[model samples]
Target: MDKFSDMTLFVSIVKNQGLAAAGRELGLSPATVTARLQALEDRYSVKLLNRSTRHISLTDAGAMYHQACLEIIDSVQETENLLQTGTKEVRGSLKISAPRDIGKQFISPLISEFADQYPDVVPYLYLNDNLSNLAESGLDIVIRYGELADSNLISRKLASSRRVLCASPDYLARKGTPITPQDLAHHDCLTMVRSNEELKTWHFQDSEQHNVITVVPKRCSDDGEVIRQWALDGAGIALKSILDVQEDIKQQRLVTLLNGYMKNFNASTSATGADLNVIYMSRQYQPKRIRLFVDYLIERFQQL
Candidate 1:
């Protein structure tokens, strides 16, 4: 039991990056955490961590030991989870991130229903338009606008949606719709800005040829919702995801443009699998609540 406690302490320190933070998280005092870590090192007769005044890092041996400890802890937790949760209620904290428009329009309502069904499961949703690193954000899921190339993560398509050019009917009526991709250079365009860079370049392809046009944007923002609202306000034409503006088009508030040309909504030259995806880490084990919630999201999105 002492050895197991030491292993837990070591992992906590590494994860928290300090003895004091680990102690706070684990409900222990800083001195207790320091003593337990020192005792583990003394028992092994080798230093596992290189600690500075403000930071801590694992030695090579400590890195290997941490990996082993993780495996052991995961196995034990799996066994305990299986024993305690046999045909029982699924309950856990589910942390998710998404774009602001989608979160408020779709995910937020579904989350309300989902929470009513599983009252014990807590949900946390972070809404921002800019792309985020799921691992660095400590979020369980990230809903993004496109597919990712990382093998460590899984990007699952939630809806069959594509990017299209659209703008408010009033804007198009005044600006007199662009005839070709080249004409966009002369028209007012709303674009997205990410990482302090303006995404003003647009890509279009038809069976005949591929074309790239760099439009001078009249307005730009980090939030897609802002750009969408601007386009609705007759600020300029916008290249947007179909799922986002479908209702607006149906209501005749916005009109789809350049139907003959398929515009690539991605910022880059290449296209990703989908315009929107629900991404999570690819792991051997996932909590039942997360699995159920993801499945529920898939089911609800399919209804759209």
Candidate 2:
């Protein structure tokens, strides 16, 4: 292996604490990893690691070398990122993440349109309901609801959004539409279970009344898309983001319930993370591809 590749392997070995584990991570066989490490140590003429049957520990020299390796690796990555700033040519991979429902219903078409305009730029879009770390996940942008607490990340509001209680026409016809938040107690409700806790309690506000009601969910799911599908299938009433069900409501597939008594929280609600936002890592320079895509997304959402 080359010097830089050896440095990378040494760092991985130290991080993973075993030759076999680092081999598995880097897609190298155990024998190859061992040979590479031996070659690296010979080139340095130093015993870099103390090895046992089950684990490896860095020698004093290895510790010093490990820190230098980290710096070099980070510098190389930063230099590559800096290269994007010099070119007006927008051609690279744009990795994006979004909630499943919004991704399917809105972001997917927007990405398709963007791709057509910039055919040289590759799009890698994945639909996920939970938050993903941009830097760790190597994601260029994440479109999600709710406010972010991380100071190292920058977020821009794409649109103001809120959840609403709605049910399919058939479900309402069978169970009857609720006129007040309390009426949900007597109705079968579909709720989300996130992080092992059910989001069964819903909040409402009106001109003269504010209420919080916790309904016993008749159907529970961790997937927002599943809950939406259940609501559409006439299984039960569902509290969903309007963004996820607006077209359904407009098509009269699902009807809004408790219009006078329930005020679904908006994107800025501190009580919940249900706002539409596009988030990226705070960087000294963003690639032209990412900047253009973010601007494009913001403009499109504004017209909504």
lDDT of 1 by residue, 144-258 (tens): 8776877767877788767889988899878888989998988899989888999887888776887889899899898888989999999999988888888989999999888
How much lDDT does each candidate structure score? Answer: 0.80, 0.81
**Model 1 segments beyond 4 Å from truth?**
1-87, 266-272
Scanning candidate 1 in windows of ten residues, the lowest lDDT window is 265-274
Per-residue lDDT tens digits for candidate 2, residues 184-284, read: 88999898877788887788877676788888899998788999999999999998888899999999999988776445533233534567999986765
Best by TM-score: 1
TM-score of 2: 0.73
Candidates' RMSD to native:
4.6, 6.8
